[model samples]
Target: MAGAGEPGREGSGQEPLLVFRTMMRRLRAECPWKREQTHRSLSRYLLEEAHETLEAVDALAAAEDAGDPRRRDAAASHLREELGDLLLQVYFHAAVAEEHGDFDLDDVASGLAEKMVRRNPHVFGPDPVAHDDATSVDDAWQRIKAEERPRAALLDGVPATLPALLLADKALDRLARAGRPVEDLDPDDLGDRLLGLVAEARAAGADPEQALRDAVRRRV
Candidate 1:
């Protein structure tokens, strides 16, 4: 099995991604469900696939810890299938856009490649990284991204669809990084207070969800 991000040999000069796109094209033309799918309609499956991929990750970790190659392989296979489904969602959306005379998959790939180079200054730019310092590298990444995509507000770009704890944590982190204080919003209910506590945890550099889970587990 090829590890993640490892390049594979081209199949007789046929680019694997292009081949996959061609397969997607055929499916769009022949498959009734695929033909009927729009970007909006496929959103639910995209979310489901992402969650399933996360589940596969957890299973793979457990399999590896158990030192069972067979179980690990099974977990890897499940992950691959889920990832393929997710990839299909990308291709499906791009195909729909292409049919409407908008941008296609090539544009998507090209833009991502350009962004990768533009963002990774330590690797692709003049400021090369001499030693691999993961922490410092991440700081550079966030700095570069901040400059590339400036937002008017600190938490303006945070995704609303993210898990509530994650969203709260991210928003709080952004506010803290920007030297902005989190105003003590009046809690209307227990949920709001929990969210506020999550933000407080982020401010204090703690994991609120893990802390809560640990506390609950002690009672069990």
Candidate 2:
């Protein structure tokens, strides 16, 4: 795998991975507060940073819609700051890993490199797959993944902590992956079900999240 600051440049001469490492090292050495941070303490910051990044993306879209170049630059600046905040979480995690002699940022990066190569056999192997045949690559990726975690169930990988809408999407996706028959839902019936739920929520003056939580609590 390529090191962060290797020769032969792209875009800028600086490598982003190296830059991240340098920032991490500086934070570790120069900042007392940063040095004292733990994974638990940094969790909220990571979530906040991710939301900020999404907000910046939204701002960029709004700016483009309004034809405002200045807003574009402001949005870009916000994006950079948000990304830095996210990187800080990585740095904090790496520091914790280093303390425990588990693994550091480098190990994380190298593992990613290995996974990428393993997933994309077309790029790394002699029998490169045809570019037009995306299904072939997808099949290969799934087969390789199954081999890697032989004991894991089909639905084991999706996180239970995701938002309800996202979790629903993931659940549906996993079902599709397991070759479940996709019988078409009647749009009129689906609309009626959704509208009834909305009406019930409004009648009860209920927060949808709380209602969903309650439903989930009962089911689980």
Candidate 3:
């Protein structure tokens, strides 16, 4: 006999997730502010949480590089908390969608699982190919992703809202992957010069975004 609040009641031993899901559902039902939120209203929070999570990750990495065990441990805990906050944004969005009859959290998770399985044929598909390195696996993943969107226009998937340096980096990378050549831009134009710098960073195996952030941090 299944009892209320039993672990078995939550499928597959995901009791914590189920409990949080229930909490979100209840919040949406009972909280006046939560009840009034639309997807548009919640969008800013999702971006803020994502950036907070990234900051947490950078803190952890910095702590590790400094070889401070105590700082690393604290940073690790902070990162975990930030990750949970980011995850709550997902649940919040899913809750909103569930109310609108769009989709539930389970549908969102299932779609992500299906996409991962489809993209990593070297691991999930039959007769798995032995990838020589991470680069090979990544190449295969990118190739499969491109193949899936055969009719998509060039630059179709790149989000325009990305930071200028990162946006230029991704655009150049996408063109390179597609075997398309970009025409040289006017050297005198500041924006074009910055784009050229992004291309240089890529050729040098550096992240232009991280490099710029680090430069600013050093100056500060």
Candidate 4:
């Protein structure tokens, strides 16, 4: 039996997206500051938004750990604001590209959806050697990624601009997955062991940066 109203209760379900796109276009044309900006000029704002979002995530994580509903709600509210700021940066970029007749938000979204379907063959296409193990999925994902983009080196895409710790984590993970050999550097002390611990965390499907950040928040 069908529900009330129309067969499709929602009226096209694209009105909100259309509204957002219209708003972005109007802002691009009418706003003086927005009119003057280019994608290169907005790069810093994108980075700033990303860092603010991460800060909010950290705060939310800490609040969740403390088991305080009030604090959690407050953090969630702040996080939502940060996410909106971040999303605006994305839409702003899309609007800028659209002005030049290059591409728009739809192109960005379509490319991402296409990439996800291509990479996650197990879920979108066929369940190739299905297993609940995360490591297996990760391994297959890396292999498929390598095939999708032929890299000159295993570390080709590991951006040097990434924070030092994150770059290390990526390099380690890529080398390990690619079966590339690394020089056996001896761990001489406690600091070296901490480096090894980061690798262990990656192997266990944990984010070392977030883990340390959470630990600091909990303890200090």
| Candidate 2 local lDDT, 168-200, one digit each (tens) | 545554556688733554557965455445444
lDDT of 1 at 150: 90
Looking at model 3, residue 131 earns an lDDT score of 97
Write the residue-wise lDDT of candidate 1 on 95-116 in tens digits. Answer: 9888888999999999999999
Which has the better lDDT: candidate 3, or candidate 4? 3
Regions of model 4 farther than 4 Å from truth: 1-14, 126-129, 181-183, 188-194
Q: Which regions of candidate 3 fall more than 4 Å away from where they truly are? A: 1-14
The residue pairs that clash in candidate 3, if any, are none
Worst 10 residues of 2 by lDDT: 2-11
The best candidate by lDDT is 3
The residue-by-residue lDDT of candidate 3 on 78-192, one tens digit each, is: 9999999999999999999999999999999999999999998888998788999987898898888888887366768888999888889888888888788566787999988
Per-residue alpha-carbon lDDT of candidate 4 for residues 102-203, written as tens digits (9 for 90 to 100): 999999999999999887887888764665887778877888888888999767877889875677688888777677634455688765676677788877
TM-score of each: 0.77, 0.67, 0.89, 0.84
For model 1, where is the 10-residue window of minimal lDDT?
Answer: 3-12
**Which stretches of model 1 miss by more than 4 angstroms?**
1-13, 129-132, 181-220
Native-referenced Cα lDDT, model 2? 0.70
Each candidate: RMSD to true structure?
Answer: 6.3, 10.2, 3.7, 6.4
**lDDT of model number 3:** 0.87
